[model samples]
Target chain A: MTAVPDAIDQALGIAPGSPLHALRALRPEFVSGAEACRAAVLDPEETLDLSPELRRAIARRVVAGAGHDRLTEGYPRPADPALAALADGEMPEDFALAALARHADLIAETPAKAGPEHLSALQEAGFSVPQIIALSELLAFACYQIRVVHGLGLLKETRA
Target chain B: MTDTIPQVTLKPLTWTPHLPPVEIEDATPRQLEAMKVTPSAKKVSPYVRTLAHDPDSYVARTVLFNAIMYAEGGLNRADRELGALGASLINGCKYCANVHARQHARLTGTATTSALYAGRRDALNPRDAAIMDFAEALTATPPTAEQSHVEALRAQGMEDAEIQDLIHSIAIFGWANRLMHPLGHSD
Candidate 1:
């Protein structure tokens, strides 16, 4: 079956049937999800009103993505001594993967405790759900970019 | 004047399985009371209470809650519990991990708390596994998340709005993971 277009593709001008399409097609749920997301972004009240099932599905996706990424990026590789040490239950300087995952889950589910002003600011800034997702992607990319630059010695030198 | 030789001593850092737990005695009675009375019934340790009490300054909490409640499309109790497990696993906060894992085990009657604490994927339900993967990506790597990454979840029958909310959930968790790493008490 042909995969549905992703909201990112629709928002960012990526064409359907391109690599993005193929990638999104990898997950059947994601294909239909992209369609639903497109509708929600297009019309929040009418199309994307929150439902219990939708919420659960969303939570599942977010947690899965984050968990996969943490395993790949945050931890030491299998060949590394650090990895072995960690697996053996040694305390690393940083937080463990499990703790991070839990924290991420909690943060994602917390309600909008911000005052009227911040909420208004976000709304005024055209912060729809898709836009928020885009921002998140942007932030992640920014962190990655900073790490790349720092690794390359492009960042300013600081005293240790 | 004769030059004196400088002496340098290297102290080897020892790795410990557990951190010295944060002491309640360090907190004031009011703070202790707040910790005791917080809604979760999970004692908000003094450190978490310190952060929660200053609700105005804890921007992360507000943003995270909104993302979970509104952007993530409003997770149910089970979903929230699962999300909590996923985040705790990724962050490796022993205290939080132990607490949430126990809760998850109690609720789901599946994986043991130890397995969850170890980040053992095999022990989790398939849906929970998928959610865990999503949470890790959102927390650890955003830009590298290929279109396929999202598609995988969709292939599993997730809807579009749900996917968007999922992203929000990850974003919120990502923010929280960082905050808790340095500021939260786990000992």
Candidate 2:
């Protein structure tokens, strides 16, 4: 069996059969850098103020926004009803963070279709400037993880 | 299909997405704690701060983001910005397109960033066009975009570092466009 690729290996496509072909991991620092990035986001043991559940929730919404079909591609996402609701367009008024995160996912899935209205909605939902920024980054990061997994997944397929 | 993208000057675009406008003064202890460790540069952009819901990932992303675009080596800022513009264009991320186009314009001058954002790849110079071609293809379809796209970069006189930088720029936007698209609008 092939060894599970590390975060750097996955991001840089450095495992058994990266699609890059012929190019070794360009810089070890880059690979480690990417690994640290992924771990910081996904790892539960890190020194972050955000809880793991919230991180997973954001991940789930991001994956849902991008496409649930990608779950098989090694994308990490959480499973939550509140987040699911937001992904589809319904932001619950009570749980502001979940609603905000859902809004962020919608922006991720349909960025081109987004407008000030969405932002206004978040404000209405009680998100602040920093909160909005955080939500945006996490929502955007969901795409990053999904895209990275999808890209690396393709490389894994090529290895076959 | 020549759509017109709004041309903002050499500054952050107008009308950023306005979330519910909750004064952060009421922020809970967790939010405040996250704020303390959040990247200092991100403090300036409300967009980056939106990730406060998931602070750890926020820090991770910031670190990765800084390293990718602002790190010591590999791709230069200009080429990286060009790659970002290309990916943003393909991903339909007006916010990212606007932001990176302005960045690209700052480095290379002559805002072809608008042209690329408008999806008018045909209007670009050969080199810029090639970078766009590769970035878009990679963004839209990474697996299908591998070998040939890399080769095309080579054909465009891109050295290994430039090619790598271009790939990171494009790939990162694949995520960035998704993120910003969900958060707000640009034009």
Candidate 3:
């Protein structure tokens, strides 16, 4: 009888296939579901009020920073130079105040900082309420991806 | 100039969400598929629809979410909801905390969640306390969640499946809290 491997096995490459390829073995439904979340966040057709480049930049920042310490690739590459810089954790001169604040919030560098004052500051920077919400989701979704990828990466590291 | 210290509330306080939901207009077939997995009763929530920009991913997330949350024969709903509420608090999503807390309260008919929301840990039963401690720890950045958390759960008489369910419950909130916190605001 074949012992069924856990998500950690397939996701971390402790099994026969690469992490990306091995993930199908754990539970196809979960792998597919997680991929779908990636497509929506990093590669979407909807012209987000926030551009795809900017969205990817946030994802880049999150993946690089999340604790997994693996998951170094698979993030969308931004074409815009400013976005590229942001993705690399640089604040360019033209960076939007709203974006900088949110990058701070999602990066989780200082948890207590993301309170009413920060929200008000973004509002004062001229973001409409809905846009602020969208930005929040974008950054948050980035963090979500970091966790998923990192979790899978961890499973790979300990595959005995 | 004298510095004024910010006042921290010591009493258990209630949490509520007050964001206006983003409403779906066309109800695209793909969007409809996504809505089925959510708890929404009518048109899909704006948040779900917004994510439907990539309908494939939306379907995938919804499917996974439903399995983790509504699947039969795992940890009971209220306990799972408590895990969610605990994670939401750590993530600072008042809206998610309110929604899941209300769900837990409604299912168990208990209103003691105020203390849980306010960061109080003294009065909880061993089970709820164990679950919340693990949830909050796991939810923290860099994840201070440790093997001791698991040991504490075992000591509380959680079987393997229940412990696995609890981990999934807390882990899913790690994903869910980040997604929902930015989608809307709550009181």
Name the top DockQ candidate. Answer: 2
- Winner on lDDT (1 vs 3): 3
Interface RMSD values, listed in order for every candidate:
16.0, 5.2, 4.7
lDDT by residue (tens digit), candidate 1, A37-128: 32332223322233323222223333333333322232223344433333333433434323322322333333122123432343354444
The docking category that best describes candidate 3 is: incorrect
True contacts kept of each: 0.01, 0.38, 0.19
How much TM-score does chain B earn in each model?
0.57, 0.78, 0.78
Name the better of 1 and 2 by TM-score. Answer: 2
Residue B4's lDDT within candidate 3 is: 27
Clashes of 2: 21
lDDT per residue for candidate 3 within B19-111, as digits (tens), equals: 443355555665566566444567445566555544544555567677668767757899889988887888876667777887887787553
Per-residue C-alpha lDDT of model 3 across residues A1-160, encoded as one tens digit per residue = 1355433333343545554344334345544555555565555555346676776676667656654433434455577777777777766666373356454554354442355566566666666654555555456555554444443343332221
DockQ of 2: 0.27
Q: For model 2 chain B, where is the 10-residue window of minimal lDDT?
A: B14-23
Candidate 1 TM-score over all chains jointly: 0.39
**lDDT value for candidate 1?**
0.38
Q: Give TM-scores of chain A for all candidates.
A: 0.25, 0.59, 0.68
Superposed Cα deviation of residue B154, candidate 2 (Å): 1.4
| lDDT values, one for every candidate | 0.38, 0.58, 0.58
